[model samples]
Target: MAVHHETAEELVEEVFLFGRALKLAVGNSDSSLLPPALTGVLGMLSIHGECRQTELASLLCLSQSALSRQLSDLVEWGYITRTPDPDDRRAALVRVSDSGFEILERIKESRVARLSTMLGEWSEEQALAALESVRHLKDTFTDQARHASADYTLIAR
Candidate 1:
């Protein structure tokens, strides 16, 4: 069935509010946790695997210079590597290091622990339903984003 405009608007509002709540709740915890911006960049790199710096920049919707700052920290922390692209002498390839995967796992565990506390009262079935819904929504949006990536203008680096 076709989605109604009002329903779509309601969904958008809910998503915005949900995102805000997530940020306010879980995004600010733990001094050791990486900043949200870097975490997001790392997450993207994890998804894309080893890719050229320029290609990663394009995929991330960030200019090369902006991406460089984040990449620098990742490299320093041994979370990721930037090496010469063998196929392209002038280009660099980016890949998440083993430590990067470990950090990502830690981040996931911490976030899940916090969220689980928040959902402590939920029944197993209720939690599973919520998980299913979120996964479905995420997959749908991911597909949409890939299709629309070419048309999106970078708003931030």
Candidate 2:
């Protein structure tokens, strides 16, 4: 079926609205856990294994001090660890600890179950297609943001 042009914007808005709703639902489900930013940091650590604080701050779009506070909190909670960097003694590398990975795994399971329930009515093919489209859209948005940043730098000079 051909999608109406006017409905395109509505579709985008609905996607964002649903995303917000999902986030709210997940946040409400777990009260004692870390905030979303900390959760994101843990997830990033899970994927990247270990990384420098500066790199993590850049990846997370947070100021160094802000990231430091979050990392400190995680360390205090025993969800992450900071060790002296092997390559640079002056620098520290942060990694998600075993406990952190356990928490992250639980979060992943909860998210998957919740999303599965929400999309239970959807056919597997339809859901996979939608997932692929969303992935592409995210990548495209990232690329556009990078280009815009480059343009801004040029204009600033």
Candidate 3:
């Protein structure tokens, strides 16, 4: 039987609601080792290797002072290190430490396991399709946000 448009829309909304609930639940869980902003910064550093503080601040849409405080905390925790940029002695580059990478790996594993358990009944094809759709939606939303406004700030708890 062909799926009705309304049914599909309803299913999409259900999935979105589930995702929101899951995020909130996870955020409240003790197992969440890092705050959202730190997690985001770590993820970006993990992918991009090392970056200057100014660049990171701009990319994360944070003010230099705010980013600096976050960086200070991470450095004190030994999760990341700051080093002088070889090309620019006055500028500093930040990179995830080995400990930080390990933390990221564990976080990725836990998140995958949690999602897989939640989606246990999903077929491989269905999961792949949903993943692709979510990725596309995320990219579209990010692009829209980038062009929409510059006053947005991520409030930290």
Top candidate, metric TM-score: 1
lDDT of each prediction vs. the true structure?
0.86, 0.86, 0.82
Q: Candidates ranked by lDDT, best first?
A: 1, 2, 3
Query: In candidate 3, what are the lDDT values of residues 1-157, reduced to their tens digit?
Result: 9879999899779879977896765533424677767877888888878999998987788999999988897898888999999999999999999998988887777777777787889999999998898789779778888765543543321
**Ten-residue stretch with the least lDDT total in model 1:** 148-157
- Model 1 TM-score (2 dp): 0.85
**Candidate 2: residue 16 lDDT (0-100):** 95
lDDT of 1 by residue, 1-157 (tens): 9999999999999989999999877776632768787888888999989998788888788998999999999999999998898988898888999999999888888887888898999999999998899899899998998767645644332
Which should have the higher TM-score, number 1 or number 3? 1
**Per-residue alpha-carbon lDDT of candidate 2 for residues 1-157, written as tens digits (9 for 90 to 100):** 9879889889889879978997787755543566777898888878888999999988788899998998998999999999999999999999999999999888777777777887889999999898898899789879999999899999999
Tell how far residue 141 is off in model 3, in angstroms. 4.1
Alpha-carbon TM-score of each model against the true structure: 0.85, 0.80, 0.72
Order by TM-score, highest first = 1, 2, 3
Q: What is the lDDT of residue 25 in candidate 1?
A: 73
User: What value of lDDT does candidate 1 attain over all alpha carbons?
Assistant: 0.86
